[model samples]
Target: MQSWLDVDPTSDFSIYNLPFGVFETRDRAPRAGIAIGDYIVDLAVLAERRLLPLPDHAPHREEDLQRALNRPTLNDFIALSKSVTGAVRLCVQQLLMASSRDAHPPEVWAHALVRQRDARMLMPLRVPNYTDFYSSLHHATNVGAMFRDPKTPLLPNWRHLPVAYHGRASSIVVSGAPIRRPRGQIKRDDDPTPTFGPTLALDFELEMAFVIGKASPLGRPITTSEAEQYIFGLLLFNDWSARDIQKWEYQPLGPFLGKNFASTISPWIVTLEALDPFRVPMPSQEPPPLPYLRASGNQSFDIHLAVDLIAPSGLTLTVCRSNFRHMYWTMSQQLAHHTVNGCNVEVGDLMASGTLSGPTPESYGSMLELTWNGRNPLRLPDGSTRTFLEDGDAVALRGWAERDGMRVGFGEARAQILPALDGEA
Candidate 1:
């Protein structure tokens, strides 16, 4: 499909991938926008002019629809149900296609568009809660082999369910936000007592998180087949970690101070409809999951993921490359397991697929794994090496799925490491 707009064939926001996001200009307030090529189609403007298309199931009054689009976050718009959001996506897709150009003149249509460079992207939604799952078999295995017995890399219960922990939602930030290296309790193996200082090992975990669009009843559970319907979209996620703190504190309880500092997500939320073409079968789970977690066929996406390290010298190099399809536990299984205990979820709640590492060393997703927990250091272009992040070192994660010359992707989730606060180091 071709668009009348000047969208390069290589663009992630193709006519087929009309992802939603929030953006604001210096003069305008934050509001919902649809990404297409190099421009953001302001939904508020289209709704104000009655140029926005709505399905019969949507609110009849144009003003009501306009209010939903002009919110500070996409949560309200997402809560409108996929029935409404799905039609809106399809309408926006058609609005861009060359064959279905609207009857309005070019100048009238141009008023609703804004160049991507002129606007600042904001968090697409207010994240009410976050859950990070250890779903990657390879990543878990690597961590186990490094810190635990190499002969038994996996725990006994790992194959039965998705291991996860509640994350700090308030710390989640949009991409481009700088991450301050957190200071916390650090106890080395040789140390007699725990020490409090700036983390010596700061790392980034390449991940993908799905946004929950619908609220569920407190006692009701979401089944595997019903999980995707409740998920509005997906985004690239960087779960920043303070490895030194985690090693000392993570034991009976999962990540706390080590992980609560910050997590970065891409601005755009790529809808599941746009990613339907990239769905693929998940890696087989051994020992098989319980009845509630048994999901059939194509539960994982074939999104290609890459991580790049940007040195202080401005040199950038791709350090890791992996695929989301190799995940042992599918997102459906994660959701099914998450809510099986009657835990209710709401709109804007995020569930992240843990670090997506593949079988090869080059595909390891985190600095801890890529460097074998600091045993091996990665050589950067500046003639420096990194076992973990340094001040001014930035981590950028990119994800996309391309087929038949069409691409659908999360633009990027990037953040630079900042030195710890004064008196804290």
Candidate 2:
């Protein structure tokens, strides 16, 4: 996987991992690009110059390839079959590996490559809808134990189907966006009535979301076996939560304003083909799932996930260490469950794995569980204790997969919390 373009060995954007993203350069308009080390190879430029060749194995027409690559968002490109996306990636790999033989001119690299520092990363797709799922058994149990009875942590229906809530697509922002503490109504334990104010318990939920590639009709159901055909790739997701607001509001119905304020995701979408080498067998389901939810292939990715909290005082703590494999429900099952009842899914839609917590206390995903609802405060390196995130606190969610010296990564989903607006309270 060596490339003429020098890629840092430790870089997330290695030659083997050419993840796609959207960026805007100072001189050029916003367009789709692929990461190769510290520079971004503009797909639009390559397509315009006829530099991207269709792989021999794939029979895609050049016109179709050009149309998809030149788009501002990756929605059109990913909306094509997975074979098309794989072909484009293969073509890029071959183009980069052409150093031994002078197949392409030097000017090709000069015109296609853009320094990452000079490019402003934008949301890779226009998300039509977002569904955040409670797929992690450990996370569900931890939250249930903390809030509900410890003896009966998991709900009765939790093991039967993948539980999820339709999220606010408009609030889903890309990495580096500042998240403001949301203002919501809260009823304290001591107070009889609820009052509206900025939330006191702001937290970050470590997660990863899969992007939908293919679109389905309104009444069509996507089976578990057919789910991967609609999936494009994975990205790190941070679903910020207002604990106080959620506790007071969530009752008969699920999350509303409490969980809808903001959600941050990494810029690059790491394709499934790039992660194929790291696939693991899906966790065995107890009380066998319904026929539609049963999967045949290896559906889980062995990606390592970590969360770091950096205080305003410049000290940082790795608050949680978890893995994508900890998810009880696989992406395929989630998608199948989502559409089993005739719900439609469109290209660029996001489905997030809710808080991927593991079996240990150190693996808890959110601040509510990590600090145990302020009863157990985390001691920071700056000699300060934190029950939840403070103003100016920056949280970074990082993830990667390394197997046999090959590494694929989802760059950090990072955001700094800003104080609530003066008049919001």
Clashes of each: 0, 0
Off by over 4 Å in 2: 55-64, 98-101
Find the 10 residues in a row with the least total lDDT in model 2: 97-106
Tell me each candidate's TM-score. 0.98, 0.97
On TM-score, the leading prediction is: 1
- CA lDDT of each candidate? 0.91, 0.90
Clashing pairs in 2: none
Clash number for model 1? 0
The 10-residue segment with the lowest total lDDT in model 1: 56-65
Candidate 2 — number of clashing residue pairs? 0
Please give, for residues 1-425, the per-residue lDDT of candidate 2 as tens digits.
Answer: 68877777888887678999999987988888889889998888888888777666765677877777767788888876777787778778778873643777778778889999999999999999999999999999988898888999999999999999999999999999999999989999999999999999999999999999999999999998888888999999999999999999999798998899999999999999899999999998899988889885689999999999998877889999999999999999999999999999999999999999999999999999888899999998777899989999999999999888788888899999999987854
